[model samples]
Target: MADTPNSPVVDAQLRRASVQERLGALEVEQARLRQELVSLSGELRLPGLYLTLDAAGTSALLVADAVQEVVRLVELEPLPGAPPHVAGTFIYRGSPAVAVDLAVLLGVTREPALDAHLVICKGARPVAVLVDRVRDLVEAPVLVEGTPDGDVALPWDGTGLMAGLCRTPEGIRPLLRISAVLVGSEET
Candidate 1:
């Protein structure tokens, strides 16, 4: 074939092949990282009861058990002008904490037990959560970016949370969006 200005098929083919090779190399790297992650996943653990609650009409995850030790529940002072979601005000760790029932707020038909523990946000002055049955200790895996569509319903818009869903030994666990649950919309 005569070499013309537009005739660069051989060069283009070579370039395409090089790009495919790089992509394959990246896939291999990803596989290695995932294997490393599986091995290392056992090492990292968060000490607390993972509470599976509902907040603002959506399911939420909260680290509850350990927080109770740090926070002290006090007598209800009463917030007369507060919203229906706001159950009452209590002193937890000498800080003002708003005790809000997770069940009612999430519109769950089942009543939330009084025995359920409270989870006060680390920095929020007057925000605390009343969780139902606190779930087992969950060790989450590293998550990757992708579309969110699965069994577990998320707090955000139908899609999943910040870190995305993690592939766990038992099943796919939805990564919790802590901030969203801590300070959910009551104004709206």
Candidate 2:
């Protein structure tokens, strides 16, 4: 007997082929998007891409290359005698990383949201920075010193915490100095 178009086997086969075709088209689109990202990065003259996040209601940017991963808020082991900004420590990839709350670092007294995220940063001193949410991946543009007038201001004193300020379509935001946040956490 020959399989008919309306038969269960033929219907299943047609569905499978249709799904495969859609997947192939999606793969091509993904590749095109990736190439466009690289081209945009080159045009922007950024050393690497940046990740934007909401830190205590303040918009900030972090170097994407320095970030190892972003994970959901996990229970942490308490660190006695650690700075106020230091929330606790969590194990990551067989290593313990101190979790620093960006909200506390920015002088916000409120607790982190229930759905907060931890942005694990890679460096000589690895630390997981807690943020309210991960916003988007952006290309770093030319930076200017100090906050520009009418721009969103840094919540904290900034001092060494902020590397500089950069303009985005949303407005001006602080480019956080990861090294400062890392080292400052240790010294304080």
Candidate 3:
């Protein structure tokens, strides 16, 4: 039997073929997008160690390259007339280094514990950041300009002090911008 173009059988067959072709195109597009994601993720990865710390209740990270050392709680000479964020000054390797209270800088009003440690960071000048505690050194991806997944909001205070957010097993940690912190401290 000769089937007309408008016949039910002919229509069904044509529709099936069209749907299959569309599916094939979609599959190819999906593969291409997957490849692009892989490439982008690799590029977004920050290559180096990061020192994670407990900033008040918030988690934060600092690039290991800028970190000089971590020292135990030391007596700091109060910088009179300095901003509250400026905890005090300390002697490091026979030179004076300003201690910036991370909690106060982040707007947290808790006093640092007696066991708190100082993360010595080298920027425009050396500064010691007072943290509640030192977490650990980790290798993680730091998104400097964009948020991960496009919809996940980071716990940032809109301060330019954070360079990015780092993804860690513990959760997302803000990456502190040492240079920005140094500049802000200088302005104070």
Candidate 4:
């Protein structure tokens, strides 16, 4: 009603701005929903030893006094007829070991260039999970449900990587899924 000539242009601009605002609102709503879902499902924190290493040796997380110790040496073997993510197989404590590239397989930037450690998970299939550094292992909460950021957070049907986050002195630690790492892409 204000003006006849400028109304069309003004209307078009207003419509465009409204669309953009709606899109932004949708994105924010989606993020909030994801966070809520994750909170609802829940995650469990298990008590175990965290190991970190580098050119030097392995170190404990919880106990600061524990001196640096060398990771147990093992022989790596090729997982013949396996997937790409599968680094190889190794023998640890006189048992078959399935080695995987922690960074590449898990979608990390790269192989932990610095410190590396093996997380020994004892379960149906005892396996050692390779990690850049074993940041302290505090009680980590579980992610009940949420839209993960990307494949890195939920790789291979939510199988490749671990779930939940652990806050440590070093930084936020991603709870590595021993099962996912053990299975590799082949299973996915």
**lDDT score for residue 20 of model 2:** 47
Q: Least lDDT summed over 10 consecutive residues: which range in candidate 4?
A: 55-64
User: Candidate 1 vs candidate 4: which has greater lDDT?
Assistant: 1
Q: Which ten residues in a row have the lowest lDDT in candidate 1?
A: 179-188
lDDT of 1 by residue, 1-188 (tens): 86664568867756655664564455446545644654667333333445454344444444443244423334556678776556677876576667765555545444444555566655424566665544444544434333345444444434223333444444444445444433342221
Over the full model, what C-alpha lDDT does candidate 4 score relative to the true structure? 0.45
lDDT of 2 by residue, 1-188 (tens): 88998999999868755664564455446435543654566332245688998888878888798798999989878788888889898888888788988888878867777899999988645588999999898775544444567555557444546655666767766777676566544543
lDDT on C-alpha atoms for all candidate structures: 0.49, 0.73, 0.73, 0.45
Q: Which RMSD values do the candidates have, in order?
A: 17.5, 17.1, 22.7, 19.0
What clash pairs does model 3 have?
none
Clashing pairs in 4: 37-145, 38-145, 41-144, 42-142, 42-144, 43-142, 53-115, 53-116, 77-89
Off by over 4 Å in 3: 1-43, 142-155
Ranking by TM-score: 3, 2, 1, 4
Compared with the true structure, the alpha-carbon lDDT of candidate 2 equals 0.73
lDDT of 3 by residue, 1-188 (tens): 89999999999868755664564455446434544654577445567899888876877888898888999879988988899889889899888889888888777877678999998886445688898999889885544334655777645547655655667777667777665555445544
